[model samples]
Target: MKRLHAPAICSWGHFYIGVRNLMKNPGTGKYAASLTCTLLLAGMACVALGTFFYFYRVKPAATAGVLNNIDWGWELSYHLPYVLISMGAFSCLFSLVLRKIDFSGYERPDVWLLSLIFITLLFYSISSQIRFLDNDEYEHLHNAWMMKEHTIPFFSLHFKHSPLLEWITVFFMSLQNPSTLIIRTMRLFIFLLSCGSLCVIYLIARNVFNSYRTALVSVWIVLCNFVWMEKSPEIRPDNLMVFFCLLAFLALIRFHETQRSRYIFLFVLGSLLSFLGKQNAAIFIFSIGLVVFRHVLGSLRTRRFGIILITTGITITALAVLMIPHDIILDIGFKHLIPNDNKFWPTRFLYKILEKNPEIFLLFVAQIFLFKKIKTSHPIFKEYILSVSIVALAFLFLMNRPWMQEMIVMTVFMTLLAADALSRLFRKTGVIICTLILLAMAIPANRRLIKKYIVKKTMTRDLITTETILKISGKNDLVFDSYGKPIFRHHPLEPRYLMYFPEKFSRLELLEKSRTKFLIKDSYYPRLPQKTIHWFENNFRKTKKDPNIYVRDMAGRK
Candidate 1:
């Protein structure tokens, strides 16, 4: 027996030696050099294209404010050149660095890539701190304040959305005074969560595609998205939901691969947390359930019935333990889903795709065409497609319109799928080209985001107008403004006024009812009657802050 095995062992040893020598051979450097040159040339070409577009297309749009147009088609077309150029430049540069740059005895490439993503997201998140709170943010701030002040019970906050966001906000507000700075604090928390989600996206991509580069590409796609950039830093539940959803998916993938009870426990934990973050996260939970069902069915073919059955039992038990409380919370908070009666849901969806996220939309279309090329047998592929379909269909049924924020679950799956499809379709060089192009297309939206959040110091005219009113009014003064209750709630001023429609109520009627000391009006309200305007001008001293805002003090004679 020993004599018979010796020849085979010797042959294997010789084969290993030959392979080792081949790897160490000097000739391979030539291939690396050639690849490096190719990448460098690509990068130079991209830079040239980016320069051209920056000058011709992006610069003009920036100057003309055409990028802010409501017409999706015109906006997309106008920004296409810049998008192409930016994407090209990015691809070219990335390829060159990957191929030519060497960092021996340092952090692995994957670690470096993740670090880069972390830094980029961190910078963006910090930049977002300066952004003025939008309407939804102000509403969240009000709710959080209410919760903090014990005006509303933590469990009984009647917001139709998930309570986790409010809970988190309240928790943070407890640590500090609830002021304008609370807005920044909440945003910072959300940004941190968003960064975590990005990391999870990279991990999930790496697990599914088994390539660091693919994972980096997946993250890059997400990073380039204007919606993600704008929304991630807002005081909202979407980023938190994305964070937990990505964790749940990551755990699901691990469970599938390892068949471990611990992963199942984690998956359940993540799913529950995700659901708490946003009620819509149930879509991801349902998708995970479908994947488990598919796996159970597959196990029957492989004759692992007993093992699969036990796994399924453990998964179900874990889910039940977490889901019981989740369901109760959701049942209490659940309200009517906002409906879009426009009957043009598909058209609006298409318009959003064209207007805001053309690059992602195109990649999705490309993914469809290249579906056959994607391995159908792969669990990640099957799970992602199934999950995306389930969520998208549910969203369509519930809201008709493809509301972008509501579609975050679908977006994550689609982003991963897009990454996978891109990997299959393009080699390293090609991947860079495709990535940069998509990124460049998204540049216009990002430019607008930068301008709105980063560059601009002054608030919107409406906000400035409102702030002026808040600044000028006394603590005990009753100020009526067209902006409505949010300003009163946010400013914590006494004698709050609810009458926003100055057109509906006569000046005498308004003054008589509330004894309002100051009347503030902005462009947001319907036009004031001529008589009402004249009455204020004749009876009171009128002060104009800007073209948009007017203040009247009844005490001062005109």
Candidate 2:
């Protein structure tokens, strides 16, 4: 017994020593393996939690936008399975692609990434909790449902706008459950795709720069504490447009690097899809041109191949121009260029100024400092200068007005630059020091804000529950609420602004066209001007007690 115990003890001691040695001196391969396993476990946990939440909460209430009081041929039970399938399939697709990414040296992303992710999750959580019942999302869903059920989306199927988003909306509406959780889950799905695109951008940048730190910085910037990430979960076209635009950007960058014709086609296709996503895609088209200006300027300087690339672009532009009808070409002028002063000009300009003043000033300062450093140190300084110049010029020209829509796009570009600036500045000052300062600033800033307003005024007090809106909105009802409007309304049935398109014509006309029956409004939200309140009150029957909600008569006779 003593002899056997000695051999066993020696073997066990050797095994423990071997394990300790592996842990102590993990080579690159071993480190990579460990990182991979850790990530897999983390991802599995996230999926499990997200999935459980989605099924138990999201699936039941998502159909509030489209299926509230409206019965479709599909069984309510089928939706959970469909959503599960969609989510599962999407996750598998992501896993396949993400598994290929070798996150070898990048260990800890700094506070910015963590902060951005935290802010994004919080913002989306807040927006998702509001539900889309009385939001613009409901109207969009209503229109999409109309398209599927009646063969027309925005009035009789003959509407001019492309049905790209509408088609997707209708597809989801077909699997209706009227659950807030479901609607949020759907938006979350898209947001995750956008996150994936950001990861792709990171990989591309890493490959091009051959610097893990730079790539991580770029990812942090892309997913920075920007407004859009928080707003993306609210059922809007911007999220979809951003995803497509980023895809196009990534493809174009790939093409620029590798000179691959397939990548060029992908760029064009993505740009096209982006255009189909939102009317503001013209900005993306313009951005693409600026990127191509890289080639033009290069050709001009080096005489590598002058005018040939420009000519090809012109040919493609001509083809695209030919696709649009003469009527639309004419309409663009009357509709957009010659804005009615009373209706759009003053408000738009003021909005632009308010939205851009701080960002523009800050970015200008950053550009001045960053350009000097970038010129001296960056490997791609030449390209950076050219790209920065293009972006600056576009920013100058396109920030023509301060509409909320434009502000979002502007924020997207500026936030990235800000992130870049912060990353560079912090690197120069030491990561640990900068991180401590940032945390110090963030905690106090958040605390001060919470104390000064959030707690004192009970601002979040009006953060209405989905149950409230559900009680107010019925089938065929139209909700008229802005993006930041109070949560509680007549019933938790109407889609708010974030859930719907921000366009004036699109929301009202599309609702009427879809034969919507009820309308709800909250007067407490100060964003609603007196004129807007009067208009809603004029159209719908006033509630006896609450000025906040206006109810529309279903029989078309208020």
Candidate 3:
């Protein structure tokens, strides 16, 4: 029995000749015909099944905005495909394990770990495309669209959130006018930018821990952190802010390693970008300042380092003053830099960690106790993350709420600390404990990814209402949109905003009296008050074409 040659196995002749031999058997003729017929039937059944669902079952549900309800046909057509794809994924993973791939050319386990990270995040990036604007992205996307149309942030629009992320979104959006593809495309782009941040995390940890395994663990911990899972995938400014902070942190690390004056310039640029993303990122700058101060004090014997730091800071400050527009400066002074709630935010940082990422919280506690015991390649590494984490937590007290959204800061550095702690325990205490901890992170993540993405898919965003409104209303019509339903129309006045207004006056009368053209009432969680909802029901006409749309009834109004 001769073993098959590699070329003989792979060549086209192998498949062609095997088929010829099978046909020559004469015994398999009827069976092969039946198999081919079965294959044909399977292929044809796809179309038959789709037609049946479309004509009879799924289409019965009126498509006003999103399908009014999810039915059996809807589940089969939408979800079943993802289920099949997931099955294929598991089969591939099983095959990878069974057939040990070559690793001799690969130098270390970092490659394996990095590969795992890549695949996991790639899944997330792709999976994110299926989701809607689940968070503040409703307003953010609208603001970006407005910015694309040359509306100035903070001055022209009532937007106080970060500007750079919106500007970045504008850059992508310029390519195409996607009525609703905006969320999916922007989310994908954000996920890509977030990947760069992950790289920085891995590199920073690798330098600090002096071990690729620990660094990889750090990256994975951040990825699996419940906060990260919720936030990182969204089209949000905070993701960009975190990315920019990591960039600045990376620059600082490089400057320390090489003692180059150029890295200082890069650090300045990253901090500026971070600030442009959000002013609350001041904590990141504070951490960078702490590192800079340490560098200055550490090298006090040599005045050269101190001189470089001062010169760079002055230069960057001057450049910022010159380059920033007058409007932006005014905005920074009026809203961003100066105004605060004066009221302290709910002290929920501990609770958020407990509810969302308990694994990280527990490991963080362990790291605090075992700080003296953990070994790192760089001595400053210990001080670097610690100072940053402390400043971030302290800054949270200073920065509770700028607007509707609460601040989530310093999570990246905290995750690194937690991962390093877990690595230390694994090295000393053993693998079993670490494995359980990993499971705690991985299992929930698995269920979430499977259920949300594969099971039902997040369809909270759509253009049905927007298209409907555009069809019905005049160009100047005011809209009551909560989730950016009407892109080109006026900014959707929120029932929440009637509530979200800082003033004591009730703007609820605007809904009753103001010539509000349309109200989008849908599953995207429009914050309509009971009275406003009743007003819409009585005063506005709900079209059968789109039940989600409430048109202004000027004819019926006295």
- Cα error of candidate 2 at position 224, Å: 4.0
In model 1, the worst 10-residue window by lDDT is 59-68
Minimal lDDT window, size 10, model 3 = 1-10
Taking all chains together, the TM-score of candidate 3 against the true structure is: 0.71
TM-score of each candidate structure, all chains considered together: 0.62, 0.62, 0.71
Among the numbered candidates, top lDDT falls to: 3
| Candidate-wise lDDT, in order | 0.56, 0.47, 0.60
**RMSD values, in order shown:** 15.0, 10.6, 10.6
* Model 1 RMSD in angstroms: 15.0
Consecutive 10-residue window with the lowest summed lDDT within model 2: 454-463
lDDT, candidate 2, 1-558, per-residue tens: 354234334433443453344344433324434333433443344345445544564333323333223232232232333333333333344445434645445334342443333343333333333323334454455456556656343432233234566677666656765544335455556656566656665655555445555555555444433344334445566666767876776776677577789998998898888767665666667755765587467658545455676678789989878997866664432234333433333354434443523433365356666654542223343343335334534543333332344444445444444445555666688657766745643453344333432223321112223334456666434455543232222222232234322232234434444433444443333444455445456667754434344566553432
Q: Candidates ranked by TM-score, best first?
A: 3, 1, 2
Compute the lDDT for candidate 1: 0.56
Q: Write down the TM-score for model 2.
A: 0.62
